[model samples]
Target chain A: MSIKITNGNATDEVAPQFSAERMVEVQRIINQYPEGKHKSALMRILHMAEEDFGGWLSVPTMNYVAGILNIQPIEVYEVATFYTMFNIEKPGKVVLEVCRTGPCMLVGSDNIIDHLKLQLGVEVGGTSADGMFTLKTAECLGACGYGPMLQCGKHYHEHLTTEKVDALLDAFRKEHSTSSNN
Target chain B: MGRKLLLEHVNVPGIETYEVYRKNGGYRSVEKALKTMSPQNVVEEVQASGLRGRGGAGFPTGMKWSFLAKPEGVPRYLLCNADESEPGTFKDRYLMEKIPHLLVEGMITSSYALGCNQAYIYIRGEYMWVLEIVEKAIAEAYANGWLGKNILGSGYDLDLSIAPGGGAYICGEETALIESLEGKRGNPRIKPPFPAVKGLWGCPTVVNNVETIAAVVPIVNDGGAEYAKIGIGKSTGTKLISACGNLVKPGVYELDLGVSVEEFIYSDEWCGGIANGKKLKACVPGGSSVPILPANLVCKTAEGTDRLMTYESLAEGGFASGSMLGSGGFIVFDEDQCIVRNTWNFARFYAHESCGQCSPCREGTGWMEKVLHRLEYGHGNLRDIDLLAEINKKIEGNTICPLGDAAAWPVAAAIRHFREEFEWHVTNPDEAQKRNFGIASAHVPLV
Candidate 1:
């Protein structure tokens, strides 16, 4: 019910932008469409920008994407906010999006959501103190049969239990620490 | 056992690779259609097969292809709608993930028939893994000289690619998918200048579901008449159902269209009955957008005839005592499940996914979600039930897309079939807060 807008104002400072390798991929995506219709690649380019900058689409990063696509800045913001996957604000290093739609709820997705809340020590849509994880409820991600599922990054962890959640969190923690160290 | 046309080679090891898929007789449709049959003949085969669109609506696929307006100097496209985000549907995801090349083969065959020099698989962003798999399959198709120029020396050039959608369920609609394909906010366009007339960069286009496109291969290979012989009546060919919810086995199953609803729920071959040996309470036979049917109506139509899985049979009683075969996202509920809560969950989903385009769907979905949330948590009166109905009535058929109707149908059906459940939440507010209104039979025993 709440209207969430990126509003070109996550913070005063924009810390980072896409790397060269990501830029190359962005260029490839832009080139996927015909000339002047590169706007067709906005979603993919925004995805690249999301991964390259942080877990979210900051105003500056979105603007950078607009520049790459040669589209208006508001055009980038409009699309980035329209999609649920594109988080305008910075999310935790690991985002736990648990499905809470009908099929998933019938199969105990609510329990999984409650378990994530307790284990992560964060309420729904809240981030942990260490900024390691963000707990959020998602609509169906087309994994109805594999209900009680959550998507963290590119992977879908289906048929989840409390123990599986703990193991996944532990794995995510390890991955986070390893990446931070690097 | 029903014929497994699309997924026949799904379990074959290395079927993900082009070699294994080809070895297992994949792309036979491509070779057959390209070398033997003309493009018009391929369309005719699909037309004769009586193949319907697999993406919820059940539109006639061949007729839809024939609608394309091929003006001079205009490019026509065939987009594979892989944004399978309906609440209870995941069949396309399973199909694309397990057998990526199946979709690729289907796309090539479809492209040739539609005269689309370039096509796209516009997949949901949430299915990132699936996007990669399909893209890899497309790459393999290119390397094998199937996707790129002069495929198999037939001189039928085609280019195929995967377009990732930023996770919006509304994009699953054809016009919205086209809008998203153009990198917009996925607002469903008003019809009249339909996609066939003007689509994807203002070019004529045809958007088919992943399953519909994949089924083209089988239809082309076996001929449309042979494909038509597989299913009963207007609903022909095998249907892939993504069975889910409280069932013994929650997975995708391919079955002939004429299978009885009872057989599908109880038989070991399909859902294997409700979980924990519980009795069936209700089911959304198709996707979440369809009406929810009570156990009695689901088993037999209003006329006392046995209900079958075919489109006509499932929708035998219209919206009064029937539902649709929308995308075959069959969701089953055991006796322990609460219809009110499930309806609320769906309301929340539609609310979240509503693109805020038309005021009825935009405002109505959110209003319904809020009201249902309150009712489920045990703080509502009987008037709220009627209020929900009123909102649904206003929302249905009042928007640019079917999303309004999709948001309206489940709410309307839940109240239509299970009004007592909502009223029980209102009357027994204290008890409802303590526990869900489980299967009505469990709470209020029959004489």
Candidate 2:
């Protein structure tokens, strides 16, 4: 699996730093733990780093987070790879993590997954040719009642249909285009 | 119409807000516990209530609290396990999303009872939106003087914060939750030094489920004996059942424990019967980790008794002829649904989520997933069913955490009850791909 860099063509050599505002947020998170245990802030910081560093963690990004926690880069790498939510490699602008567990499967999530693949012109875990969408299957996302669901960024789109998926894609494409033009 | 303790005011508009929640007798538990009742008194009330852990294990909540070790100058902590990742369970998320303050209030009262000033709600990352909702409620709580220093002038101080986990099902286990809270990989620690003795950052800690803590509000408000009177023997208090899959009404319902399993499935007040008017093929009454029961075994017990929703009732005949009320994740399957495929799906989930800690769970779960996959897709022999049973045995009792047993049970129970279905998959490979083995004709006769 090749890593796709979402930001400027910077490799692992690039050292990413949180903006001044995010630094304040980082300090607040660090303060939530006891003294000398700022390491407790690693997971939240890694989450913030993923968001700020173009939705994936590169080696340098992980190292930067380690530095913020005053821990080793290996510590950040171990955690970032352990959790499924963290994207170790750069994904497309939008990643559709569709739930494919038992309950979701019982409610036709398989059909939803196949439909998403057909619409996106990419197989599971494959990014679109245009680098617009990445389709991935997720375990039960705690939204079993509203099955056939996919999570995009922070929003959960549940009780999905083919039409809703199409509309979502169109809206995402439109949103990206408008934001780029701005 | 039975009873609702946690979600009683759920439908009230703006109940998620502090003012609205307070107006609806929300923080009365906090006031009552802090002012009148001592911490031990609060603990005794919960013990009297007979409330079990709502997260799955169904351990007594008050007993778990009484086990907390208190040494001089060592601060204790209370962590709420909000990581609801079990395949068919979403009740915690529903409870947290709809009534955030119920949990916040429960934390305050529970924290005061535990004599701990600092607590945290370790929520799964997928519920980020719900976390924000809870954080808003926490801020509302702080503003209203229910949280922070010397709350309500009772000379008791407490601080509560929300910690977000980066998506791992094992973290739902208390030890793994503490490890994750300390910013490590969510690997389950071996017991002997349970979290009650040595927990987060080496302090004596108590971890309770979101629903378990939220239920404390009613226990304190109504007294433990009153709370105990609501449900059948042992399995006291109302439970939040998140019903899904092939159900006419697939959503979270506040069920009074001991409701008949048949009524819960067919009554309009509960699941309202199977979807498309189809006959029930099978059901996983609890979360996917529990044993799967066929239609005949679900509504009635092995001895021809009516199956109830209580922990003891649902688990009447042990794993051989019963299932658990685990986390109240009621999953229904209709006639057309395939048991082999659903079992494979669940195995795949456990495999994907195994945390790769203990070899039995880490390796055995994957092995089972592969074998079940081949069986589901119509490329297996009769011996493969026994091989699955073999794998289930190896994984069940040989792990540091229950995740291993959880992964093993459904596959074991599926094969035990539906061996005919597995054999049909092998005997008629091509047909199996085209259609499911609808309801199994060879159900074990009730004793």
Candidate 3:
């Protein structure tokens, strides 16, 4: 993962057309409310950046958010960085966040990890050599009862064993039939 | 793993259905309270149970309920706080998502006791799915004749609503929860009326946490004294602890409150032990809002007393050496993790979540986070660390609510326990980067 950060309130030099378009729409989202409180849309701005920048925000994308919010880049970067849902860098096309915290750990997160390593031939944070998925180990996903869980995109696949992990990966492969260049 | 207690009634064959709950001794409390006992008696029963608010502060639930000024002809509201945003805490989320009806049952019983005709559950916005589950449960409740006009022929009426809140840690504060329910900016307000006197739409209100209210059903059902006998002094009944960070067993464990911290961590019943055979370095007994206790102090206080999990035992010497059992968020740390980096993570959270309500919290959290971030990256002087301490002192009680204090405690405590690690961060930069994230995370799954 590559991330570039700057100190000052930076501008969006290499801006995307859609990001700029959505920033204007987000400005209208701000206009819905009274002046001096546009910061209420801070979450929505970060949300837009997440959608616009391929499911994550770069430091530059956060800077663009700050420029649009008419606040310091630090302000936008701060919110972008805090939330667990908001990612600073792009994971692979199939982002697999396996739960590494307690409950899941108790119920065989280790065996599930070994299976993913053997199947994907990469370490936890490393992407598959083919780049089909980038695996990141995360803190608790909060589904303790359904321990040994793995999240494939937005859905949580819980009570996972080595076999269940394989089945989920196979289903993902079937869903994404073709390979592409990044 | 320790067996489930609070989650026992969640999905047991017929738990969701009212008939099933009644068969299991459910709304018998509401019936007993109305026909057999007065509202004051119900209040007294809860008082006798020695149950404290599960929402971080550990305030007395009965005292909070009685503090309500339920004057004649004025409407009273019971706002059930389900905004479980504390990092290590996921107990309330489980209660709301799995057995939405349990909260519904507790709400009706408590609202009846407080003379409140209406109540609301304010949940975190990220858990939008919880709103649907709870709403459907509320519908079931209304259809079953357990809620709304003359409930069970007891001449009592109760209505419940669900309010979703946007992300802001400070909104966990009761006053801020009320402001969010009113569709405002979700900022903390000055507390003089204290919610009991004036809250939610300017009516007499009682804002209890999801755990606090849920505990009520058990208290009233078992009778107050009986419930009080379950746990230790001042910390009665069972508590749902969300253990996280570097621990071996990290899940929600519902244990009687008197269980010692050692029993909770090492007995193989709760968290089991620390992962990777690593030595325990420190622990934040509560959520990040409380001071972090060093491993030595945690094993035994500065005066060399074994640290137990009860309210009094945990906070024996106060902040100088004691830590609070806040929200029961036991975050374990191993020696390998950089204290400065870990502290930076929390400081950043507080600063972003300050709500900009007061200068002390608003600017103070920001400055401390920035200085800590730079200091952690080897760009700070010894003077910067001193400056961070001074800034925290100003933020500690100078805000409208406890948010200010919440922002400062971890920063101060992190330094108190591991000032050398923080200084090492400034003295050396390259070494900090090589350190892995969250000491327990495996680069690969275990085989």
Give the DockQ (2 decimals) of all models.
Answer: 0.78, 0.77, 0.06
lDDT by residue for model 3 (B43-93), tens:
999999988999889999999888899788988999998877765577888
CAPRI tier for the interface of model 2: medium
Q: Between candidates 2 and 3, name the one with more favorable DockQ.
A: 2
User: In every candidate, what fraction of the native interface contacts is reproduced?
Assistant: 0.92, 0.88, 0.01
Instruction: Residues B64-175, candidate 1: write the lDDT tens digits.
Output: 9999999988889999999999988999999999999999999999999999998989999998888999888989999988988899999999988898998899999999
**Per-residue lDDT for B176 in model 3?**
86
TM-score of chain A of each: 0.89, 0.92, 0.75
RMSD of 2: 4.1
Candidate 2 per-residue lDDT over residues B366-394, each given as its tens digit:
99999988887778888999999998899
On DockQ, who's better, 1 or 3?
Answer: 1
TM-score of 1: 0.96
Tell me the TM-score of each prediction against the true structure. Answer: 0.96, 0.96, 0.74
Error of 2 at B293 (Å): 0.5
Scored by DockQ, the top model is: 1
Structure candidate 3, residue pairs in collision:
A102-B250, A103-B250, A110-B446, A113-B445
